[model samples]
Target: MSILYYGLSNSSIDNCTDVDEKVKHHYLPVCYGTIFIIGVVGNITALLVYLVKVRPWKSSTIIMVNLVVTDLLFMICLPFLTYYYSQYDSWMLGIIMCRFTRFIFHFNLYGSILFLTCLAIFRYVAVVHPMHANSIKQKRWGTLACILCWAVAVAEISPIFNQIEMKLQDNKTYCFDLASNNPEFMWPYSWVLTVVGYLVPLVVVCLCYWRIMKELKKGPHKESKKRVRARRLIVLILTCFIVCFLPFHVLRALRIYTRLTPETNCMLDRWAHAAYIISRPIAAVNVILNLLLYTLSGDCFKQAFVEMFRCDRLVSKTKDIVKVAVISKPTTKITHDQSS
Candidate 1:
């Protein structure tokens, strides 16, 4: 989303040509290369650790696994973007690729936010209503909830299918916004996405974590273990969401304001572009952070990593123990025979 914002912002500016194209060409490749490598490795390892090692999945882990999968899917599309930017605003991939890439980008944004919202709600239910939570957090219900999240995300970002287009200029095609020039559509769209994608979800997360913390304070010693774990997870989620998303949304709001006002300052536009570019890498970092959070908060994840790496040693030890038991049985039989 931030990448798209930067591309759109750049397209909006008339004097962008005077800027150093080579710098953009060099920087975008390096930036996207770094993000792609880290994001792919981090998210893939997270998904594998959660799914293969941590079998018998819990609802929280399920949500997290899906989140990692979404992030991975988004990361897969970055190479095309890297190429597009490296070509100095030229898009070599055709119109379909542009639309598909944009779709994946927005899909990750919407899906991740919704899943995080659901995760907070799940925690709230588990902590606030422990007995009822088990009944509600069944596999069937979780599957349904995941389905609903995907449905909502697809529906929300459906506008992009029609709104995005390839712009041709000076015999070069740039994949950017066709609707960004119109304040009538742009401001409302930005606000709607911000509210649905960030504002509402963030409020829910805060409220859920707050209630969870209060409940933990009143619970007994044994429950304290679970509460402390939940609190840490909530804090991690809150921190990631705020740190990664706040700047991007703030820039979006500012961009909308600048669009609505009559006076357009070039300096503000440039700052917005820089903000927009910086936000992309930050968003990618957030995707990677989710994996770290899972490793830290999830017992299953830790146990799985240990077991995965120590499986051969455990197998060898088992074999040695079996051999010792077999030898002792023969000695006991032989001693009995001699005594008889």
Candidate 2:
């Protein structure tokens, strides 16, 4: 999900004035409420699988953990938003919670993108340069990458707090996303985020996956299993990119350009605004899809899930105990025979 879309959903003062109130009063709440339920379940499941079942020090686990954290953080903020929209634009939560909520949304939006980029780069190195993957795939480097991603996401999105505020209008309070208030800053910021934060990373993911597929095709027949797995991961990445982020950037670009136009009328504004409201939820649900994607991408996720839920270890211990009992019984019988 693009932060710009999320900002637009919250900050569009024009929306309260122009778009159909029923969208906010009735339908929007349902969408966000559903998101809240599913996002919480999926993100929590992913978090536990990584934290408990998977080894923390592995490079892949590092990226997966951060991605899950980002999603979980966003899920945590959904209740506040769900309540706000449920009230039909009333915001009794004050400015700080408003800003904090919006800030967390952006943090999740960008943090997910950055961490995914790291995963793509890591996979590229692992597949394309197997021998050298060992050096850069160290836990320390993964930790450093995660820290850098968080720091950069924070720096990029912190200015948003200045643009957002609570508004009292028409007997209702509104948590307004003021991103459009300063068109100059927002326009450039949107472009930078769309390109550098999202587009560039998306391109990198595609390129790496494409290269990986090409290499897989060239390998020997015994590597066919690996090739098939690589293709699945590539498909998963591309599907996620297309479904979650593409519409957001396209609509965002249209929204920005429409705002810049001198002839921007009510009809165009209404369409763009409503489209964003509907599409934002779709993007938000990507966090849930990400958990699914993680499961499909590797056997490690499946094994972790089994470890988290199944009694495999307990069964193994029981078998060991039974073996010990059998051995002792044979030894005692031999001793009794000798004594006799």
Candidate 3:
């Protein structure tokens, strides 16, 4: 989600306040709370399964781990936001924190998507260009690529620092999502984020998956284990793109277009903003869906994930049995004394 969406929420309408603002006040706390809880559990589980269970990590594992790290970082920022929206009138934190918090969300959004794009690219090379896959699949290459993705993400999001500020209006200090003060810059910047951060990666993922699927169909290994993993990976990543990325970008663009245009009816503008509000948290769903992508999508990771969960279940059951035994011992002693 673009940072300024809530800022865009105030809108070009004559009234300083609108329905979007009211909706945001009630909507984001619940959405943020839900995403935060689910994402934390999912990501932490993925982390444990990877860190403790899946040993001897590969290039793809490196990328997936990096993706998880980004999601975790983003998850860390959610509680503060949940609190922010719960008491929507003002920001308890100052501008510096407001800027830092905004930056973390922006960083996670692009970083997770880019890391996911890298996975798609890695799969494309592995399946479609086996001859060169080994060279590109080296651990160092994965590390270098992750470094480059971080650099690019930082450069792309650097502009957000200037766009955001804590606003004091009517004795309330609110940290604006993006300061509405500069529509000239914010409107165009939103498009740049959608294209570079959202659309371009989406196009790349589509092309990669399309080619991978085409190659798999004609190959003899169509039913092979690797092929099955590739197919699953395709489904998971595509779901994320469609559910988490597409709607938010499309709706945000529409909202921006309608807001800036003259002669647009109030109803249309309100609808646009409302749609944008819905899509914002929906886009954040990537952090949750990403847990599936990294675990079930990878070859060794999938096999290991199953074993790890079984191990955890056994451990839990063992603890319960021990607890029961300890309680039974005390009751047996009391009965023996009474009988004597």
Question: Per-model C-alpha lDDT, please?
Answer: 0.73, 0.73, 0.79
Q: List the residue pairs that clash in candidate 2.
A: 11-177
Pick by lDDT: 1 or 3, better one: 3
Which one wins by TM-score: 1 or 3?
A: 3
Query: Candidate 1 — which residues are off by over 4 angstroms?
Result: 1-27, 177-182, 220-225, 260-262, 297-299, 311-340
Q: Candidate 2, which segments miss by more than 4 Å at Cα?
A: 1-20, 178-180, 222-225, 297-299, 311-340
Q: Rank the candidates by TM-score, best first.
A: 3, 2, 1
Residue range 205-256, candidate 2, lDDT tens digits: 9898888777677747836665666777778767767887778767766666
TM-score of 3: 0.83
* Alpha carbon deviation, residue 9, candidate 2 (Å): 20
Clash number by candidate, in order: 0, 1, 0
lDDT of 2 at 231: 78
Candidate 2, TM-score vs. the true structure? 0.81
- Identify the candidate with maximal lDDT: 3
Q: Number of the top candidate by TM-score?
A: 3
